[model samples]
Target: MRQQERLGLILDRLAKHGTVSVLDLTTELSASPASIRRDLKALEDQQLLKRTHGGAVAAEVIYELPMRYRTGRHQEEKNRIAQAAARLVTDSVHSVGLGGGTTTTELARALGSVGRSLKVVTNALNIAGDLSVRSAIDLVVTGGSVRPESYELVGPIADRALAGIHLDLVFLGVDGIDATGGISTHDEVEAQTDHCLMQTATRVVVLADSSKVGNRAFTRIAPIEEVAMLITDSAAGAPDLERLRAAGVEVITV
Candidate 1:
């Protein structure tokens, strides 16, 4: 097939599956691994996708874009952050809360492989769905109206469901996270739900990439004090890292 046609097919797969491995592409396209890598590299150069350690995801921009537009960017870093965050969940832990967005969603994916049964409470429809099928995870979704862009179920139903439960840990994803300004996300209703999740969890560990480390988004989720720890990639700026450290929050950089 032509390179243009191959690139289009790869992106289509990414859009459909949320991820595409090089091995799968090699099989599907009946092409060499070298050829598949080249195609991924080409799409990455165009900023159409972000090449991961094994494959690619939809490329995301710097703005508060939709989930499809922002899931693939800095994926490698996000994976590392997810790994570090997942390490916090031990066998003693029972319930966990997950907020919406790519980073938290990645964390949910990581939890699926952990050899322990966990009760997961989440307002994000995608995250809940990801864990729902895993026998190791006893999933409790805060059922409510689903938001199209992020696939998070916010509003009264979700908040009310979480209100009755206390969680061991909470992993949150946000558009921007500033040391002084605190953690912030895009939508107001989602922000409100995030607050409820935070209040319900004993320890809140936020999963965010370096891009969101010092930036400020539309709505505030909580202040810096609300967070127990922050997990991010090495690409995070030293200035913001130092500021967060000074705030007495344990900042883990992978």
Candidate 2:
């Protein structure tokens, strides 16, 4: 594999398992230990992982989501899904809960355009800022420690804040979803926070594009049934859609 791809795989493994030993990367990538060490060193230099005694551990702090990167991938599809998701929010949606991810970020923007006179609750600092200035919307940012990568507040403080609030709807974004693993992500802390968000909200809606479907990620956040609605682009294939439908998930395509 190319060095970049190999490093991505190493990061994925570390994110999933918490650590990646030299021998582990060597075996997984079919590379020499020296090559894997070099790759690890490069990743360490980028601050994506920390070098341990025998392997590398993922960095505790995630980098903030860059607008350039977020805007490029699945831009059109995310727009479609965002439009469809916006239609679900009516005058009855008094309270809103937002999660972290590129999709949910877009959903926040969509909500800003259509949702007026609403109480918005979110752990995402960016989303809070996005809706904060709007006169028609009352924004409530969940209290917690900030995770720099996603600009999200997570941990006990956020969890406690979530426990106290009851939302009419919660919008979630995910890294991957599979029948076996349900919904999953790259970070364990975010997964735990997402689980709490699911529980605290009256109705949970997951906003993901077609790419996330049927893909098993490192950390399982919530089961399929926990989501009352799965909103995605029209490209979600037949088999995955069928699987989601069979599992009693309300699937909505934009």
Highest TM-score against the true fold, candidate? 1
Residue lDDT tens for model 2, 1-254: 67766766676677668788998778878999999999989878878789998898878986423332344466689988888888888878888789987788888888887747888889999898899877788888888988876788999988888886788999998878776579997778988998988887889988889988988767899888787889988888879988888888889988
In candidate 1, which residue pairs get closer than 3 Å at backbone N, Cα or C atoms, i.e. clash? none
* Cα-based lDDT for every prediction: 0.85, 0.82
lDDT of 1: 0.85
Q: Which runs of model 2 end up more than 4 angstroms from their true locations?
A: 1-68
TM-scores, one per candidate: 0.75, 0.74
Say which candidate scores most in lDDT. 1
Each candidate: RMSD: 8.2, 7.7
lDDT of 1 by residue, 147-173 (tens): 886899988888898887899999998
Which residue pairs of candidate 2 clash? 62-149, 63-149
